[model samples]
Structure formats: structure tokens, C-alpha cells
Target: MSNTPSQSQLHNLAQDIKQWGAELGFDSIGICGVDLRAHEPLLQSWLDAGFHGQMEYMARHGLMRARPGELLPGTLRVISARINYMPEDARCATTLEDPTLGYISRYALGRDYHKVVRKKLKLLAERLQQALPELKLNYRPFVDSAPILERPLAEQAGLGWIGKHTLLLNQQQGSLFFIGELLIDLPLPMDAPANPECGKCTACIKACPTGAIVAPYQLDARRCISYLTIEHAGPIPPELRSAIGNRIYGCDDCQLICPWNRYAPVTQESDFSPRQQLLQPELLELFSWSESEFLKVTEGSPIRRIGFERWQRNLAVALGNAPYQPRIIEALEQRQAVSSELVKEHVDWALEQQKLKKDQEQVENRQKARLIRWIKKALPFHA
Candidate 1:
């Protein structure tokens, strides 16, 4: 328990941390030294391209994200942990196929992962401190809350490899999981990084509805549906609205298409399960919720962070993409009457979409009727 522990002690502690992590419901855990200099240039390049879009925080931290030791003085190792978040019976394909239904990302269907993963990491850190009673442990837990480059740290820690879609993918568990870190001063023995296994696979790239995946292992966040729906604040771009489809929240298309996800296991944690209402919600039903109702339904969920205005804005786009229905037109008209400028803009767009479909249907109906009349007159013997 000395501040300057022996190599044997550090090695033993690393094993104990993994065991404790498993007991704490983590799917996997690994440790790595704070030498991410290899990744600093890549991070700088990503920011330079403005691929991060309006996420100024990503650029604000600069290279500090790749330097964990600098962010937290004396940080020697990063304890990266993974937790599976795929809910059982998510019915992703069914929901996505039904344009009338709102397809929220499976991760947000349950309680906010930031709260769940951070709490577990804090407990794990406490256990580490308790085990090393004499060693005053300086540590901090992060779950998508900081400027730290978590995926790179996770990969370096041997948890998984960064897949073509830019998410960490375990050969066995895929990418439907959350990664959290405990930056500590403990000199834990590090694990070897996982080998990349995404060879000859362009499934994720081809499957992206918005062409966000510009190349293998590269992403243009400006065109990513997840960024538009969750991160970006302004209007959903006019060009991408039709492609947005019915996904009202973060998208899972790339993950869903990855072959590795076939091995992704369903989560056992009840906290990760989808709420009954959100499991297969209709777009019209979601669009009809008042701001208070929206707040009440999404309370304690990750969806709450986007607030009601963007929530409605997203729904309006989905509704516009849905098939022509009088009820949908009525809902858009009603919402347009009292919504804010942002929501109103999307609502008006939805109205135009509905009107176009309505006109086309009417034209087709008239053509069909004329054809029927002509057939009846031409075949009088049958008549």
C-alpha cells in the first residue's frame, strides 16, 4: 500500500480491478499508461477539418484531451471500463421500417447512461482507494462528461478497437455499450490494445443514411444524424430532413449494420431497459405531447437534455417523412399554430411535404377513375 508500490503489487491490483469491475456489472475492464502521444496528431487533424461541427468543447480542450496526465496531475494509468447497453427486444428494425413510429436510439431508451456509468465508476474508484489504504489515491471518473478522448483511451486500455464507424467495437460485444474511465495515480499494469478486426467491411459506411461516414474510420459530424438530432442546435438542415427518416433522437444505423453487432449481447441491467411508452411509440403520438408532457415522459432519460423545442423540431421532420395522412397534416397544422420560430419552420416544411403527397395521391386517383371509365365503355359486351 506504499505510494511507491512494487511491480508485483501494481500487477495484483490490476487483476483485482478487473474482477471488481465484473462484479460491478462491467462487461470488460483494462488499464493503460498515460502515453497517448500517438493519438494527439489524429485528434488535432480531426478538429482541424471542422468534422466536429458545432461541438466547440472538442476544440476548446485542444491536445489536453490526449494528455490525461496533464489534465489530472500524477495520473499514471487510465482504468477504462465497458458496460453493455443493448436493451432486450429493442425491435429496432420494426420501428425504423414504420415511418409512423419514432425511432429513438436504444441507448437513450433507458435511464441516462452518464448517470448510470458514472455512479458505477465512482464505486469502483472507492473500492480501489479502500484496497490501497496507505496510498492516497488521486482519481476522477468520467462518462462522456469531459474533454478526454475516451475511445482512444479505451482502445489503448485493450477494451476494444475503434471500428470503421468511429465507435469502439469489441469482437465479442460489438459497439452497443458505454465506456467510462477512472483516471488515477496508481501505476497499474497495462493490458495490450485489442487488434483491429474491421477488414473489408464497408457495411457501416454504405448504411449511413446521411453519408456521414466519409471514409473508413472517419466521420463528418456535420452530416451525422446523431449530431443533427442531439448535438447541433439550429434547424435540421433542409437537405437532410428527408433522409432523417423517423429517427427522432440519436441514430444506431451504423451499429445496427455492423456484422460484429450480431454478437452483441443484450444488457442484464434493468436500468438499461426501455420504458414501456418509448418501446414503440408512434410519431403522431409523440408529436401531440405538450411541452410539460414531453418533459414528464422523458424525465431522467438522456432525451431530456435536448429539451422540448428540439424534441418537437425532430418530430416535425419525421412526420413530414411519414406517409400522407390527414391526421398527420392536422397535427402539423396544430403545432405550427403555437410553436416557436424553430419548430414552426420545420412544421411549415412538414406541411409542404404533406401537401405534395396529397396532391400526388389526388392526381393518381383521378387517373385511375378515367382508366376505369374507358375500360367500361370499350368493353360493352362484358358490361
Candidate 2:
């Protein structure tokens, strides 16, 4: 039922795919050949170094994550796509600076992108088949769900360069987007990789609270705040708690400090707009949420993946780092009995931090009293 096409016809079909992708709401799309053998060793090295942290899934997938053809049989080309997720109403910097407000990553402020991007990718694949029915096209869409090295695939497809912080960065769009891909049978003409433009920039590295970016293009997820808040289910490590600040979901200091993001546009997709409760939410308010409240608010959002226990654990740490307030102490102490052991430990830690703050304030007051007494005694004759 299929006929051979000349090189020109195949090239034209490739062009049509991009148009269809745009119409279906993708910000950009590009195609590339399936050889990703080069990134396999880099992945293995990260695993060997145990940089993936508690994410056993990364170790389980291994190098198949880099091999698109092996994962999706008969795949000759990969159509990589990017969708901006920066919500317009998100005050990323404003929220980060306020110790009382939780700074959820801008990407997670909106609806979960896995569902959004995957649906669009599937539609793109369907349209490609409809347009070129004679070829009996077959394809599979992926949105960070499968064992796929999405960043590398996007880079090879000319979507963007992998930045020093280990994220795909478009020269024009910065690094505030989600990437999805469609592996297909068509031998599409390939696009060249984008030019790396992060010249001498160490902002992302220096901005990381936990120093997770050990080197350019290297990320130790173990120390990454985003990973601790979202991926790791057990208690967050004690050493990193204070550095976490008000980030209850994911951290965005790296992206916020990057100068290239100066022109990062607000996402055109309405689905990415921030939800009411998530926008600059107060730490105490979020902490007060019952499991039902948490589930209802984060229903279609990515934060629900962490569940209530980890959510409480993250909030407890944030409260510990918050400018010491009596109410924050009361709130943290009241939850100990009602919480899981993981949450209780973090709650106890927050109480200790509050107690230390009380001690520090007392010492400062005593010193101030002595200074005042000395000043009065010395200047008594003048007065």
C-alpha cells in the first residue's frame, strides 16, 4: 500500500511536520537521526559517580535512555519539540526573596506538563500519518515519562544546546521550557545542533543553594534542592535543610540567576498559567493544608507526585529557615504528634532552629544592654 518517494518529497514532508507542530501549540520542533551513542558514556559516568541520588529509575534505565532506536523499534528519526512553561503571573524572584512565601518552581505552578506535552506530541504524530498516509507511518510520543535522555535528544534535533546547568537552552528562549519527542519510522532530513551560547557564565553554578552543579554540564542531583523537594521521599538531609529556604516544591535559583533568561517570554500556552493558591503562597498557609486540601489544590499539578508526607517535610524545613516567628514555632510544634516520623523529625528540627533564634536574640539584647550602660556611664558627665 506504500510507494517509494524521492528525496525531495521526503524533505517536503519534514517541512510539513514542523508546520503541523506549530499549529498544535508546540513552540518549536526539529528532527534528527537516531545515533546518540556519544551521550551513553556520560550517563554511565553520572551513574558510576552516584550523582543520580535516590532515583533508582535512572540507574535501571541505563544507556537505553540514550538509544532512541533501541527503545522504539523501527525508529529512524526523532522529532523533538519544546514548550515554554514559564507562567506569566509567576513572581519567581519575588517569591524566592520572601522567606515567608514558598517558592515553587515556575514550571510546576501550572498543570503538569507531562500530560500537556505528551498530548500535543501524540497529535503531531497523528497528523504526520494522516498527511502521508501512503507510507503507513508509525510513531511513539514521549514526554519525560520513558527511559529517554530528553535533553540530549532535543540537542541532537537542533532544538537547543544543553546548557552548563544540564538543561536545554535556546539562545532566544533561554531554558524555561519542557521538551517532548516523537520517534518515528520516517527518514527525515536532520537539523544541526544549536550553537552553545553560555560563554563564561557561572551564574547557574554560583546560584545553586546546595552547590549541586559540580562543573559545567554536570549536576549532582543528590545535593540539588529540586531533587530533594520532589524526588526523594525519605527525610531530607539535615545539612541541606537551611539552604532550602522557602522552596517547598522545586528550586529555580539557577534559572532565575541566568542572564540569558532576561528575555524569557511568558508561556503562550494558557495551560501553563499559575494556579491561585500556588502563586506566592505563604509557608504557614501551605503547611496548614490537610491531605485532602493538598490533593484538591494540586490535582492536575506536578506537586501531587511528591505526596503529602514529603510535602510536609519540605514545608517544615522552610519554616525552620523562615525569619523566626512565634506563630511559625507554634505551627511546627503542633504538627509533630499528627505527622509521620519523617515529618515529625523535620518538625523537631524546626523547633530547635526557633529555639536557637530565641537564644541568639537574647545574647544580642544582653550585648546591646551592656553597650547602652557603657555609653551612659562614659557620657554621664557630658549629659
Whose lDDT is greatest here?
A: 1
Tens digits of lDDT, candidate 1, 206-281: 9999999999989999999999999999998999999999999989999999999999999987899999889899
Q: What is the lDDT of residue 368 in candidate 1?
A: 95
Candidate 2 global lDDT: 0.90
In the range 89-144, model 2's lDDT, one tens digit per residue, is 77777888899999898899889999999999999988877777677876899998
Candidate 1 has which clashing residue pairs, if any? Answer: none
lDDT, candidate 2, residue 375? 82
Measured on C-alpha atoms, candidate 1 has an lDDT of 0.94
| Stretches of model 2 off by over 4 angstroms after superposition | 1-4, 373-383
C-alpha RMSD values across all candidates: 1.4, 1.6
